[model samples]
Target: MTFSVPSPDAIPRPDPSGADAEFWSALRDGELRFERCAACGTLRHPPRPVCAHCGSRATEWVTSAGSGEVWSFTVIHAPTLPAFIDQVPYGAVVVRLDEGVFVVSNLLDCPVDELTVGDRVELVPTRVDDELTLPLFRRA
Candidate 1:
């Protein structure tokens, strides 16, 4: 199949409710945030209800430095979704941010063959659509 970028309408929107509400909102405003425990100094991703490090319910959001290195990745050939059948050879990368948090994102500019573990990447807050913003990355 020929490759084509998915239309904005085809992309799913984040749920406006729940622990991820502020996380998604910050990205739309051109910022990246991670959950941190207010009761104890610990960071967590996926926006948990309580701190994994400590059983604290008090949490805060920490802004990222917008720079990181590729921790791991894989080039997907299997069709993940109907809207991405043609985009099979895309790279799915896990980036280790400067804050020591791992974030899953796709590369914005580099090809799969050129991408490698430990490659420095910089954040590019892209507005996928009027209501969706993504923290895409690129080779630095």
Candidate 2:
């Protein structure tokens, strides 16, 4: 099933800064990236300036396997924004990436009521525009 999302102009866009800029750039290139500490090898998301584990300032972007399980989720029945009104009843999922990090994104192509805590899923990139591509998910 194909999922519907708000157009690039219709939704808020992330303003990538510092290390976060690399994360967003990888998405535009159709790959999902996370940061790994150069010192402790701890992987993290939402990119940070320093490693949470070792407090190291050195980090590197690593490509994800893009497979995970649904750790948690919520089905939105109410429209929080006018742009999302048409997409109400969408599943917002917290995916536990195979690498042991969790990222919050949307789950697509499945009935919201049917989603389970351990459902296997894979990355599905939805190109919002030339500069932005949102990482959505579907059942593996």
The CA lDDT at 14 in model 1 is 72
Going through the candidates in the order shown, the clash numbers are 0, 0
Alpha-carbon RMSD, each predicted model: 2.3, 1.6
**Where does model 1 exceed 4 Å of error?**
1-5
**Model 2 backbone overlap count:** 0
lDDT, residue 87, model 1: 76
- Cα lDDT tens digits, model 1, 11-50, are 6667677778888889988999999999987989889899
Scored against the true structure, residue 49 in model 2 reaches a CA lDDT of 84
- Give the worst 10-residue stretch by lDDT in candidate 2: 1-10
RMSD after Cα superposition, model 1: 2.3
Write model 2 residue lDDT over 1-140, tens digit each, in one string: 23477877888788878888888888888899999998899998878889978899998888998999999988887857877777777778899999998998887778777878999999987789988888888899
Q: lDDT per prediction?
A: 0.83, 0.85
TM-score of each: 0.90, 0.93
| CA RMSD (A), model 2 | 1.6
